[model samples]
Target chain A: MANGTLVLIPTPLSGQPLAFSHPPEVLSRIHKITDFAVEKLQQAVHFLVKTGHPVPEYKMGFHPLDKHVTGEQLQDILAVLQQGRDVGVLSEAGCPGIADPGARLVWLCHSRNIPVEALVGPSAITLSVMYSGLNGQQFAFNGYLPVDSHRREQTLKTFEGRSANDEQTQIFIEAPFRNRELLGAMLELLQPETRLCVCWNLMADDQWVVTREVQDWASASLPENFENKPAMFLFLATPRQKAVSGKKSARSKSTGRGSRTTGTKKGLHRKRYNPD
Target chain B: MANGTLVLIPTPLSGQPLAFSHPPEVLSRIHKITDFAVEKLQQAVHFLVKTGHPVPEYKMGFHPLDKHVTGEQLQDILAVLQQGRDVGVLSEAGCPGIADPGARLVWLCHSRNIPVEALVGPSAITLSVMYSGLNGQQFAFNGYLPVDSHRREQTLKTFEGRSANDEQTQIFIEAPFRNRELLGAMLELLQPETRLCVCWNLMADDQWVVTREVQDWASASLPENFENKPAMFLFLATPRQKAVSGKKSARSKSTGRGSRTTGTKKGLHRKRYNPD
Candidate 1:
């Protein structure tokens, strides 16, 4: 028998109705799968139940999947697929196998020639980029930075250097409780002209997405309740296009070390738009 | 007056029904907006009509937006927002401002303190990471490489070096016409054990997402019609985790230059699963 497909299902980022983030087809797709490997069983059960899955939670196969998911545990999931039953993988939130676990299962299916289908849904990282107003053409999601203040400071310097040198935007996330710590370090360590974007409580009624230069943020503050909510932080230290005497152009500063000097001098005026 | 929100709308990847990739809310949201800045005017009209917008194509405000969107043209869009009228931004496909034009506009909105809202939708980059089954926790989308063969080769070398050094999954794309050329270059240039993933015609009936070592792909061929479709190429040159005596753990290889050597030897057996 042909191996069953492994479907990667993305979940809602907030408590909003599923329709807010997913189309009718995703609802129908969820109804058909009876086996799952999820980041958290309770959350998966809750999401499936919310999706109106016909199967009771008691009868469905729920496998545990986290960063530590083992090869043996994965084999058990593969055994179900080898039996020709489709298994859906879900993250606690957002798309599975991106910032979440279950990638190993997806990789395993690939090795064994099992088909993997990823359903479209909300991804905070993607949303952050779109809302950031930063360079989306080239970017990196560095995941999380080092927790030690000293190491994280060093890492931030490296990321900023790359942003300028490669013209790539750097994106990284933090545990909810550390949002403030990260923001503080960024303001203190990054160059004054570097753009910093903070997106908190995405897809929520109280969501806030803001971008400003580090110098501007030094005096401003995060939302009072932002510390506990999931957030994504991104920055771009790349210089803006060289300013002309008569007109402004949309081109980016060219890449490499020498452009850094030109970018720093001209990029400051990037935030200022005067309708001459 | 408060500046009107700059809504970034994501479009479908293929010609499938809007229901296939977006929810009812997106349609409603599109219907309420009359002003738009689109990558392609014809495609935007087609999409708006498909969404069943009440306004006639002739009656809507459709401004052109591409890499060359001028500071003057953006001033026009901002002028509309300044009047407390919302303006929607659309890419030819997928999410706008992400490997697509319009991020600068999004950035402009941020600079002006205009509320920028990015609705949930399909992102090929996000989907590629999810389906690639590579290291999705950390990844970089390098957009496109140089068109010159030699320059592209050198950039690929740099990307591979970064991937191995930083444990990052590198994502990139090519013009559909040049897909074959890029694939051939990749096969010849990348190391044997590096994993490469190709996702073509995503969200379409004929979509294909596959990941395998460079060695494996060197022996295979792309789908016959893949050359003409919008495609994404991703690779992970990082070494696999250190092999245990009797078990395969899910831990990733550590970051830094030293780990590269350890990753090389142990990673060769990564694809082999002895279910003993």
Candidate 2:
């Protein structure tokens, strides 16, 4: 029999309703996998149940691979595939392995020559940048920064510097409780012209996606309702394009492709962001 | 009347079946959006039609926003929302604006203070890294590298340097026709220790995902089937952990959180690939 493949499953971002972030097809895949390796056993079971999966009907079983699982144990899990029975590795929330704990198992699969695949689903980090209107062509996902105020500020400096230096958009997430501190650090460390985009509690009904220059953010404050909610933040310091000059009528920015960007002279008066 | 929000829709990666990448809710959204601004009008119509939408019954209308659509015209599309009607922005393939053209409309919506929401779908770039088992804490998506052989080689060198220097996973895509040329450049330019991962025709039935050190890649050849398919590539050069050492019965690398890597005296035999 052919070796069974290790499927990488994606879950909803925290606070997001499961179905809101995935399609029926993704759920169908969940229904098919008989065995799973997840961070929190109860949470994974909860997800399957919530997504309309009949756990007993599918005869699904959960195997723990949180921080405690040993490499030896993961290897044993690999034996399931070697035995030609498919198994899945689920990230607690969002796409597994990108700032999540399932990466080790994916790597282990590579080492053991097991076929690996990742299912499509919601990715908060990617969606945040896309909505930010920042330079999406080149961007980095810098997971949580240091807890120390001084180090956190330094980290922001590096990201801001990269944003200016290579025009790479910098994306980072913060612990819900530390949200205010990071925003304070960002306002203090980022330059006035630096653009900051924040998405509060993505995929929730109360989701808020907004972007503005640091200078524009001075007088503004986040709504009281958004405080302590998990958020994704993006900083972009890439120089603004002079497409507003009206010199090039049918110009194309790097990713614009077939879109003609003939900026009408009137557009120059408005705040337009042109990322090259 | 309240304004309708602009929905930034995600299409399946080229060659991926629609249902495989989206759920019924997304299709429902498409069913409701009577107005659309797409990279290719014909393609978008065909997409909806193929997905079982009665285009005429939905009373949908297409407004062109191809390479020739001026910035002024995009603003006109935004006006559709201001008029209390929702408009969908569709990409030719994949998510619009990330690696495609729908971004200008999204940015336009933001500049005008119109609400923007991104629908979730497959992202070949993120999926590649998740499966690569590289450090996901930080990564950059460098859209398309230089096309000239020498320039492309130089670009690859910089990416390899960054991968080694900061352990940042580097992702770049190649035009289908130039796939072979890019692969050849990657092999010839990268150091033996550099890790290269390629996922061909992602989300398609024939997709293939694998990673190997450059040296190991030398002994292997891509399957004949992958030649002209669109592909996502990743290169990671972080220092290899010696956890493969036999001293411990089971040990995990970094994500193990509470565990300390003491650089055990027992761990130097592994074929470590440090990109630097």
The candidate maximizing DockQ is: 1
Model 1 DockQ reads 0.29
lDDT tens readout by residue for model 2, A178-263: 66777888888899989888778777777787788887877666868554577777888854443212212222222323221110
Task: Give the top-scoring candidate (TM-score).
Answer: 1
Where model 2 places Cα greater than 4 Å from the true spot, the runs are: A14-18, A57-60, A225-227, A240-276, B54-59, B66-69, B240-276
Q: What is the lDDT of residue B21 in candidate 1?
A: 84
What's the residue-level lDDT of B154 in candidate 1?
76
Clash counts for the predictions, in order: 0, 4
* Tens digit per residue, CA lDDT, model 1, A1-276: 988889999898889888779988887988899999887788899999999999999999988876567778888999999999999998788888777776678888888899999998898888988888887777898766666666677778978887776667898876677778889999899999888998888888888888888888866667997667777889988454432221222223223312111000122122332211
lDDT of 1 by residue, B133-200 (tens): 88776689876666566667777897888777666789887667777888889989999988889888
Q: What is the lDDT for B62 in model 2?
A: 69
Look at candidate 2 and give me any clashing residue pairs: A23-B23, A258-B67, A259-B67, A260-B67
Error of 1 at A235 (Å): 0.2
Q: Report the C-alpha displacement of residue A250, candidate 1, in angstroms.
A: 19
